[model samples]
Target: MSDAEGSNEITTIENPYAYLERDFSSENFKIEVKNLPKFYGMNEFRKLLNEKLKLHSNKIKTTRKNSPYAFVCFRNEEDRENAINVLTNYKWKGYDLQILKAKPAPDPLVKKRKENAEDLHSNKKTKTEEVCSQEEKLKNSTIPYHNVEYDQQLKLKLEDIKKVLKKFGSELSRQNTELKNWIEKQKFLYDGLPCELLDIRFSDTTEGYRNKCEFTVGIDEDTNLPTVGFRIGSYVKGTTAVGPVDNLVHIPESMKVAVKIFQDYVRSSDLKVFDPEHHTGHFRQLMARSAQNQLMLVVGIHPQDLTDDQLSEFKTSIVEYFSVGKGTPAKVTSLYFQKIVKKNHRDDIVPTEHLWGDTHIYETIMGLKFKISPEAFFQINTKGAELLYKAAIELAEPSENATVLDVCCGTGTIGLCFANKCSQVLGIEVIPQAIVDAKENATLNSIENSDFFVGKAEDILGNICFKATGEDVIAVVDPPRAGLQKRAIFQIRKIPKINKVVYVSCNPMAALQNFVDFGRPESKKVHGVPLVPTKAVAVDMFPYTKHCELVICFERWDKISSKQLQSEELVS
Candidate 1:
């Protein structure tokens, strides 16, 4: 169920079939019972389900994000799952369905459970306790010692590590060894920013990596400081460069081997690897890649091969991202050969998308390109995205005359989904390339009533010249990992005509923080204050992984009063 759909009081269900019999058409809602078992054939299943639905007024409101179990609200629990018998070994949809006789409302303790889940140390102590026990045994045990003072020495080493991390601007909370074991890093970045010569920065030790490692530095032909696996960077900050994302900083051995293999394989007499200047080859490669990719998309031919289109495509298709090969210069043109090979580096961390081949990017109804960057956000699962869009549409059944604002509109997906159902749609984003792609996608879709702008949502949104009143406007925001920036939330909180907000986020922590920012009592969030959500549902986007996407709908309790708006700061 949606988090905020606190209908601790669901009393009615409106059946669409009855409405259709009364002359209205059943259009938006439909259901399909999946892969039912042979025992309860479709006929019996349908009959049984129909009887169950009848008790619930012939309607079953689904749980938030289409959870696995149906949140069927029967008048009484006794009849909800009265299978032929409790002992009957029957299955539906190829899976056993367990009917839970749950309280009408979720456990009041759920809020507390969520809080407990937030604590990192609740489960951390087990590891820490283990570490302590190991240390104690180290000094007392009689096992032969290559180093009898290993425990003391390790403690000193850990202290040194603390100093190193501190130098690099990191504060490390003591790792609980009792609950865990060996520690190591694949590589760390200076300034915590990824560098021309930076590598992975890991936490607790995992398979394949149980100790510290080192790297050897060398210049490649292109001369860009390829942060190859030769030498591992340290977590100590200010050592070279600093960055915001610094938790990981160790280069794994696989990366080193990969780098060596790449250097050795391309330099054979039969193959020519391009070797440009020493200082700027990497940056040039970076630039050339961007420009060449843009060109490639436009003409569908990469610049690596000056050969005929088919030949060139074939040649570049294999190692395009691994490494660049020397280009052959012809009378009329030049070709560069760089073979980018795919290899596993620091096991857990490696670039996954588009590195090997073409990635299928989603498009808006208007055909704008949803420009996805190597590191940028794109919905990973496909079928899941369609379901999410449908849910959003149901929430925003836009009338023909409505105006919709799509904020942080990645690839312009949301706006395009609503384009045909609305009069005017506007999308806002900060990435220039993504905006360009979004525009392209819009044009591709042949959607005529849409426009997009590039900038922070709050700043650009407040300045949009279009008049918003008298227009049925709905604002849909799908933000990044960090969730909606405070300024954007404040702006959204004060939107004049938009009375509803569909807040989508990949991070629940940030989402909750943003919600508090808008709905909390003292933050001048009065306009945002009314966004008491009617529902919040979590979608399992990453099956087998912990990550989940949350969709929250907040309906305004009241429109912005004069006092809330008069002194409200304009979004930055």
Candidate 2:
């Protein structure tokens, strides 16, 4: 496709869905295919892989790595070599072949070694033993270095420390399995887990390990996705609400083992695995699978081991995979070479809108572009989000004159979704980029009755609605995993004339309980009236993940608006 340049010198090009549908075949070996433009979300790569697998023999497998560059694998080195040659020789997807000896898979005997090492459990402390003081900011402090020698010495220590830590950490992780199982065993003997959480999965990283689990207990009175601002919804990012722990509850041991097996399976797929934040590989699949937008294909590379140039190459290849437009024919370029030979490279992604011609709209259900950013929250499943919005609107029961508040509006999909049906919508978000995108999105859709504000929900919601309709105010809040802030809940409980609230929570497990706590007997009152929770619907936004989204409706059981909760809110 002849690409047109944008004002910013970013190129806009035709969509590559046509090329994606053409006949393609996988080289039977794990050859490294280099230098093609990636599609948004890496669909182009997936489409190519899918097309090749369909047209070619299934005996050979084409895989990707955590770096997300193509790595075709065969049953043996010979087939692998053959596949490598074909890929290197061909001009597929406008890129040239550059296959070489990728890091080989760890020997199968290593599995035996890992298993035997599990027996040395009581003798060593795992790296998980060195827990940072806090969860969010885990550290003593970042030490400043005066010289290159300091860096060299620390780098050496880092390797030794990593090895020792991983060894013991593995032991600790095994113990975690035992401990988690012991808890679950108690639950199985009885009816279920003693605590409200439904299930737990064990995961370990070089840094530490996390006990990922689900909770049955949920936020109270959550209904549909709240429409709190012009382009807003609810989702909490951090987890500060660690409740009191009760060890008396039983945990399931056998289930944990089975789950561990499943976890291992998920880690072996075509989806590349790595932490974009830490630049290390971690088996974060459990959480990744929870959202509709998250898709996991396991590649055999551990995230922590890729070299700097490899990382750059991986990022470029992955970015091309994530893009969806016609790729400029790949020739050896300074850019690709720099990626192929770099150190401490920071470039890992492309502004997808720029790469995909900026013409491709990130449309939600309403066909309005979503102001999605890398950091801003968007529904995990791009398509499934439509259903969620549709469901939220159904419960909001909007009229032409209804005023809507879309809180936690990451890119404003929910608010813009309901704008055509409502009188006006106000969207709120903490991300400046999101607010900018949300406003642009409204303009792009030519919708005038909506505007997005840049601020946290608790701070701006009161003033955003103060001058507006005291009645017919419908709030749709989709908070992050940590759930709503205490202040936001209080405001929801007491918002005068705002009797209807639709809560769309993705982290229904941990976050939902917060709402339940807020609406508990001791919670604040409406104008002299106490609040109550009303349950609604559970929508499976992610088909594969254990997590699900919930929409609940909260109506004032008492005659008071949340003005009564103001004193309690102030105390909090």
lDDT of 1 by residue, 316-356 (tens): 54244233443211010112332222111132232332333
**Candidate 2, position 217, lDDT:** 13
TM-score of each: 0.40, 0.42
Q: Candidate 2 — what's its lDDT?
A: 0.45
Per-residue CA lDDT of model 2 for 343-418, tens digit only, reads 1222332222221222222434557665433334666455556667877887778889888889888787899999
Model 2 has a clash total of 80
lDDT of 1: 0.42
What ranges in model 2 sit over 4 Å off? 1-361, 521-529, 559-572
lDDT of every model, 2 decimals = 0.42, 0.45
Q: What is the lDDT of residue 288 in candidate 2?
A: 14
